[model samples]
Each structure stands twice: as C-alpha cells, then as structure tokens.
Target: MNKMVKGRIYTLIGAIGWGLSGACGQYLMNDSAVSPIYLTALRMIIAGVFLTILAFFKQPEQFKTLISTPKEMFQILYFGIFGLMLCQLTYLIAIHDSNAGTATVLQYTCPILIVIYVSLKEKTAPTVMEFAAIFFALVGTFVIATHGNPFNLSLTPAGLFWGIISAFTYALYTLLPGKLIYRWGSLIVTGLGLLSGGILFYIGSASWQYTIQWKPYTFIAFIGIIGIGTIFAYTLYLEGVSLIGPVQGSLLASAEPISSVFFSIILLGEVFQGIDIVGIVLILIAVYLITMKEQLQEKHMRIKH
Candidate 1:
C-alpha cells in the first residue's frame, strides 16, 4: 500500500483502539470494584513501561538525548503531569460518571477550545468558519448535556465538569509538547512523557495501597486499556501523523467518537436518544469543518508555492 493508504489505515486503527479503550474503561468502572484513580494510575504505569521499552529499542539515540537536557527534562515532566496525567484522569472520571459516548463526544470540543485560545493569543478575531464551529460546538454540548431540553441536563454535573476539563487538558496535551516532539521525535517524547506522568499519578494517588482484584475480566480490561488503548493507539496515531500530517490525521481521528458510540451501545447498552444523536452529529460536523478548512489552507499554500 501507498503511504497515504497506510496512514489512513493506521489513523483509523488508532481511533478504533482509543474508542475501544474508552468502552473498556466504562465496563471496568461499572463492573469491577476498581476505583477510577487506581485504574488510571495502573493503565498509565503499564502503558508507560511498554512505550518506554519500545522507545529504547526503536530510538535509542533519541531516548538518550531525551534525558540529557535538563530544560527539556523539566518540560517533559510538566507535560507528563499536567498534560498526560490530568487528561487521562479527567477522561476516566468522565467515563465513570457518564457513558463512554458522551464523554468521548464532549472531549471532541477541544478543537473549539484551541480556536478560542489561538485567537486570543494572536489578538485577532476568529474567522467565519471558526465562529461557526464554536457555535455548533456550544449547541452540541448543550444538546448532549440537556438532551434537547434547555433546563434539564441529561448528564450528571460531575460528568459534564470532568468531560469539559478533559477537553481542555487534551488541548494542552496536544499543544505543550510540540517542541519536545520536534526535538526528540514523537515516540521518544511520548514515551518519556507517559512515564513521567504515570510516575506522578502513582505518587500522588498512592496507588500501591489499593488492593486490586485479579479477575479474568479485570485482567482483560487492563490489557485493553494499557496495551491497545494507550500504547498502541498513541504509537499508531503518531505514525499516522508522521505520514499524513496533523490536519489529515486529525480529520481521520474523528472516527473515534463514532466508534465509541457504536461500542457503547453494543457493549454497555447505553441508550442514545434523537437529541443525543443530533448532538453527536453537530459536534462531528464542527470538527470536520474545522479540519477540512485547515486541509484546504494547506493545499492553497502548496499551490501558491
């Protein structure tokens, strides 16, 4: 297959993997006695270890360079803690409080947050398309939370709060590590960042005190969360980005919530009403519009050059 085809396939696989992880997370939280904090810590630690080992073998030079610079080390540590750790914790919390589909769709609002942030930072008004995206995102969020009723919220307050927080942290996670990824490559930066963040979570949560029940289903969920969800999804998505560029990769990753919704219905028996489906469609359309605009701009620039 050509690079483009491979990139698309990788991106789709990565998205599906993430969607499956969220579904598995919801199942584990509902079925098992595992605390979200403990599950988050364990998943991070195992995925971090796996990614670190992979990085060591695949890019030893980058791994060596990653630890050599004190400044970058601090940045990585910060990224790991604030970016990766917080993102995962809040996301899992959302899943625990709400269904996987709701959490996943709400988290997709990150692009709108990114638009607002960039516009503020650049001291410029958002363009028309951006305004449209923001509007759709807001309306979509309201619909999802309220289930078509303006006054009645379908999602719990805790779920809504954590879901929005997860979106913000996810934006930070994407933005904060640009320099490190450029300098050390995505694999190295991501591996070390995961390790650092996982360590921080473990320390803060005192996860060792939690007595884990080792049932077969629990073990399977752990594998899904750590192995397929974190390590494989991250790795494949980064590889896809390397091949197809961020705009296209992100566009492809819109598949995640769709897969999340599908899996949630089948696995968790989460009922999606008409309003909820409309909310999902609007959010996805907003994302598609924004990403498509970026892709078009890139094409225009290439044509101009």
Candidate 2:
C-alpha cells in the first residue's frame, strides 16, 4: 500500500483505540471502587514502562541523546507534567463527569484552539474557512451543552469545564513537543514524557494507597488502557502524521468521536437526543473544514510554486 493509505489506516486504528479507551475509562469509573486518579496513574505508568522499553530497543542512541542534557531533561519533564499528565487527567475527569462521546466531542475543540494560537503567534487574521470552522465549533458546542434548550444544560458544568480544559491542554501537548520530537525522534520523546508524567502522578496521587478488588475485567481494562490505548494509539497516530502530514492525519482522526459515540451508545447504552447528534455532526464538520482548509492551502502553495 501507498504511504497515504497506510497513514489513513494507522490514523483510523489510533482513533478507534482512543475512542475505545474513553468508553473503557467510563466503564471503569462507574465501578465506584475505581478511582480515576489511581487509574490514570497506573495507566500512564504501565504505558510509559512499555514504551520506554520499546524505545530503548528500537532507538537506544536517540533515547540516550534525549536524556543527555539538562535542558532536554527539563523539556521532557515539562512535556510530561503539562502535556501528557494534564491532558490525560482532564480527559478522564471529563469522561467521569459525562459520557465518553460528549467528552471526545468537547476535546475536538483542540484544533480550533490551535488555529487561534497560530493566528496570535503569527499576527495574522484567520482565513475565511477558519472563521467558519470557529463559528461551527462554537455553535456545535452550544448545541451539545444546551441541547437546543437555552435554559437547560445537557451536560454537567463540571463535565463541560473539564472537557474544554482537556482540549486546551491537548493543544499545548501538540505544540510543545515539536522541537524535541524533531531532534530526538517522537518515540523517545513520548516514552520519556510518559514516564516522567507517570512518576509525578504516582507521587502526587499516592496511588499505592488506593485499594481495589481484583476482577478479571479490571485487569483486562487496565491492559487495554495501557497497551492499546496509550502505547499503540500514540505510536500509530504519530507514525500516521509522519507519513501523511498532520492535516490528513487529523482529518482521519475524526473517527475518534464517531467511534466513541458508537461504543458509548452500543456498549454503555448512553442515549443521545436528535439535537445532540446534530451537535456532534456539526463539530465533526468543523474539524473537517479546518483540516481541509490547510490541505487546500498547501495545494494552492504547491500550484503557485
């Protein structure tokens, strides 16, 4: 297969993995006995360990280079704490407060946030398509939150708040690691970041104190969260981005919300109103528009050249 086809497949697999992880997170959280903090800590640690080992085997020199300098160490630590830790924590909290589908949709605002940040950094106005995308994102979010009723909210305030925060942190995650990723390779950087973040989470949460009843499903869920969700998902998604560029990769990742909503409705029996579905569709369209705009701009530049 061509790189584009492989990239799309990888992107789709990554999206499905994340979508499944969100739903599984909700499932685990519903157990009442499972603490979200503890779960997040454990998941990060397990995935970090796995990835670190993989990175060491795959690219030992790059892994060594990543940790060689204090500046690089600090960068990895910062990326871990702010980028990986906060992003995952807020996302899990959002899922705990609301359904997986809603949480995923809210996190879709990251693209919009990225656009805004780039505009501010570059001191340029957004393109017309970008403006339209922003409008659609806002209106879609409003629809999802309010469910077409101005007075009442479909999602809890905490859910909405955390979800937005998740998106913001995700945007930071995307932007903060570009230099390190370029220099040290994405696998090494991500592995180290996850490991550092996981250590911090362990210290902060004192996760060892959390007690849990051992169930088969609990173990399975933990494995799924760590292995498929974090390790495979991040690895595959980054590979896809490298192969096809971020715009097409992101467009393919729209499958995340679709998978999340589908699994939530099917596996968890979550119900969505017509308005909610419409809201989800609009948000997805907004994401597509934003990504497509970039694709078009790239094409136009190529044509001009």
Candidate 3:
C-alpha cells in the first residue's frame, strides 16, 4: 500500500488499540485484585522497560542523541511526568470514580483542548466550523456523562474532575512530542519518556506496597497486551502524525471513542439509547468539521489570492 493507505491503516489500528485500553482496564479492575493506580503504574513501568529495550536495539544513534542533550533529557522528564504519569493517574482516577464509558467520553475533550492550544499558539482565531465541532463534542460529552439524564450531575464529581484533567494532560501529551520526535525520532523519545514514567510509577507502587501477583494467565496476558498494544499504537500514531499532520491525525484518532463504544457494547453489554446514538453522531460530525477547517480555510485563501 501507498503512504496514505498505510497511514490510514495505522490510524485505525491505533484507534482500536486505544479504545481497547478501557476494556482492558475494566477487566483488570474486575477480574484481578489490582487497584487502578497500581495497575496503571505497573503498565507504565513494564511498557517503559519493553520499549526502552526495543529502542536501544533499533535506534542506537537516536538513543545517543537523547543522552547527549540536556534539553532532550528534560523533554523526556517533562513528558514522563506530565504526559505519562499525570495522564495515567488522573485517567485511572476518573475510571475509579466513574464508569469507564463516562471517563472515556470526558477524555475525548482533549481534542477541544488541543484546538484551543493550537489556536492560542498561532494567535489565530478558530474558524466557525471549529467552534461548531467544539460545541458538538461538548454536547456529546455532556450526554455521555449524564447518560441522557439531564438531572444526574451528582453521579461522579471526582471522576469528572479527574477526567477533565486527564483531557488537558492528554492535550499536552499530543502537543509536546511533535518537536521531540522531529529532533530525536519516535523510538528514542517515546522510549525515554516511558522509562521516566515507569520509574515514577515504581516509586508510587513502592510507597503503597503494591505487590505483583504471578498467578493467572489472564492477569499476565493483560499486562503484556496493554503494554505491547500501546507501544504498537503509539508507534503507528507517531508515524501517521508525521505523514499527515496533527490536525488530520487527531481527527482520525477521534474515531477511538467509536471503537470504545463498540467494544463496550460487545464486551460489557452496554447498550446505547437513541439519544446516545444521536450524541455520538453529532460528535462525529463535529470532529469532521474541526478537522476540515484548515482545508476549507486554505480553499478560501486560494480563491481570494
């Protein structure tokens, strides 16, 4: 396949992988005695080790650059703390405080945050379509959070807080790594960031006396699947971003919640009402609008020029 086809395939795989993460988390929470915090922490650590080893072997030169530059070192540390650690901690906290579906929907707010961040950075106003997309996404989030009941705001305040924070952290995560990837390549930067995050999680686990159980193929497989799956997803995601630009990449990634919804229905037996379906449709339309803004704007500019 050509680069475009390859990029789309990668994007789809990444979306599916990310959507499965919630199911995996819920499975671990239900089937095992692991706390979300401990599980997330372990995930960070183990994935870090796995990726670190891979990076060392495959991209030795990039690894050397990472070790050589103080700025690059700081990038790893920053991403580790903010991107990996904060993202996992808050996201898991959201899941614990609320249902996985609710947390997942709230996390989708990251795209809105990303649009705002980019708009601010560029000192340019967002197009009307972008605003419409943000509005649709916000509406979808509200519907999902309320479970279509407008009066049920008291279900999970803590979960909502953490979920919102997780969204912001994710926005930063999306924005921060582009420059680093340009400088050091995806493998080295991602590997180091994972290592730093894992170390921090290890410290947290140590403090809490979180013991790892070595029984049950389910638990063992869960860890490996989540870790390796994420690595594959991230690798593809970075490549897609590089090929297609972040705006299009993020729009493609917004399909993640669709996958999550499908998995939730199949695996967890969660059913969507008519209202929920409508909300999801709106969200999809909104994402399309937001992503197409640049193309639309470029067309208008060409007409004017």
Per-model TM values vs. the true structure: 0.97, 0.95, 0.85
Pick by TM-score: 2 or 3, better one: 2
Local lDDT at 131 for model 2: 94
lDDT of 3 by residue, 29-94 (tens): 655555777777677776777777888888888787678889779878788877877787777677
List where candidate 1 sits over 4 angstroms from the true fold: 213-216
**Residue 275, model 3: Cα distance from true site in angstroms:** 2.3
lDDT of 1 by residue, 91-203 (tens): 99999999899999999999999999999999999989989999999999999999878788899999999999999989998889988888888887788888888888899
Question: Per TM-score, what order, best first?
Answer: 1, 2, 3
C-alpha lDDT of all candidate models, in order: 0.89, 0.88, 0.73
Clashes of 1: 0
Give candidate 3 misplaced runs (Cα > 4 Å).
118-124, 147-149, 205-208, 211-217, 220-225, 240-245, 295-305
